[model samples]
Target: MMTIRRRKTRKRRSPQKKRSRRRRSTKRGSQVKRRRRQAMTHRKKRRVKRRKKEIQTRRKRTLKEKVKLLVINLKMILLLKLKKELRVPQKTRQLQKNQPQKSQQLKNLPLLSQLPKNLPLKQTRFQQQKLRPTKSKPLFLLAKPRPQHRLQPQ
Candidate 1:
């Protein structure tokens, strides 16, 4: 009988893989290094949050500015159209020259340009006051007290 040799199986150790800077700094690092890394990450996260808020505010402001510009452009276009329509032909100009009374009447008519810039478009304070009841007290407060019924027959 040939002597049987027993083969021993050994486990192979894998090569050490290099850890990333972040992982090394945070995980396997000393307490001070990990704390520093955590602080830095916290600061970066705060900066990112602040930047996002600022960007959002900028976007809102830009939207409002765009709307204001659009309103201004619309007003300008309306003024241009009004100017075009107001242009008088030579024949109409001659006719208007003959009618001074009509021109005076037109001048007296209340136009948007003639109105005060700060004038309220809604109902005036005086008009609004008229809509309210004239009485100072409410209806419930002014109601006459009913005679107390006798709880027990005297």
Candidate 2:
């Protein structure tokens, strides 16, 4: 009666099945490790690229700054040369002003002056020539000729 009342038994798993399950778990762990390694390599490559870009940018900026400095230096040199030219003329004018009274009087004389301020008191050679009229025949006649093709069509 005890045997008749016994519950149905279930089969036990084999050692080979347990071993295969363990192998599958290890394979999955190795796959996870491979993925982690791939991610690390990708990150390293990106970092190297970013660093190279940063270096390139720095080089370009430095080159631009050098060019700008060169232009500024050139401008400063030009300005210095212009200032020297202007100063020489100013100094010459000052030296002329410092001369004695006799030279100043000579410079102020009407006949000796290179620049004229107003109309002359006496008639010049040009004015005398203009005032005298010459007796000569006219070079051209005041007349127009009729066009030969005036009646032609356009």
Candidate 3:
């Protein structure tokens, strides 16, 4: 009987096999890297959006506060102006209330019994004359000589 020997099978590979395998692996690595970069960029964008929202809310709050303050200030100013306008009437009414009725009645007594009304009438006439517009001379006219100055030596 002859001795039988087992033969080892050789592994077979094409020339382009290594290059194709390397290209496929490189493509997968690049895809993974791109996904990671995109995820980072997305997170950054979300953070920026959140910050912008916060800033917008803050601005809105500040604007509302300013408007509220403006309204309050306007109300206060109106109240002060109204109070000022009211003061004169209030003082006049108070003065009217404080006057003595007897004194007022005395003024309406007979002309002989009452004090002379000439001074008050004169004052009122003066006031009326002051209120009236006086006839103004034209600015270009020369003045006439007075009689007293004419009598005097030149």
Candidate 4:
């Protein structure tokens, strides 16, 4: 019985409005009217072009993307700084070790001088002269000893 009453209520509702299907016609008016219509269409086209340019500029980058890029750049800079900070102590330690070794070698020179003195005097003089010529050779050719026959005077 309730279903029957609901169906009756639905039937009693007002009919929906219907749209007209007739084709609308534009007026073929005076030459002045035609010119005015053409001008309006041109203005509309220009406005649409301007709107498209604005949309393109807005699409290039939103504020959120700009912030993300800034964050990434900051992170990279911080990482580079951290790497430099970590390397500094190691470099200082290496310099400290090398300084002591150089000083100790210089101090031991007088004590270890006996072995060098026993070596042939002419042999040591020849070695010193050879070192002067070797400095003039190209770096790549230094791995192999130069031929004795090709020795040239400066």
The whole-model lDDT of each prediction reads: 0.68, 0.68, 0.68, 0.63
Tens-place lDDT digits, model 1, residues 21-138: 2364444448779899999999999999999999999999999999999999999999998887688677887897787785575566555564444433355597556444444643
Q: Would you list the clashing residue pairs of candidate 3?
A: none
- CA-RMSD of model 4: 18.4
Model 1 global lDDT (CA atoms, 0 to 1): 0.68
TM-score of 4: 0.33
Show model 2 residue runs off by greater than 4 Å.
1-22, 90-154
Best by TM-score: 2
Provide the RMSD of all predictions against the true structure, rounded to 1 decimal.
20.3, 22.9, 20.4, 18.4
User: Candidate 1 deviates by what RMSD?
Assistant: 20.3
Per-model TM-score on C-alpha atoms = 0.39, 0.43, 0.39, 0.33
Best by lDDT: 2
Q: Per-residue alpha-carbon lDDT of model 4 for 5-113, expressed as tens digits? A: 4444544433442243334475555667989999999999999999999988887767668989999999999999999888789779688767767557556543433
lDDT of 2 by residue, 1-154 (tens): 3656778697788998767764444578788999999999999999999999999999999999999999999999999999988778877878867877765754654452433333234566976555454433111111123354753577
- The stretch of ten residues in a row with the least summed lDDT in candidate 2 is 137-146
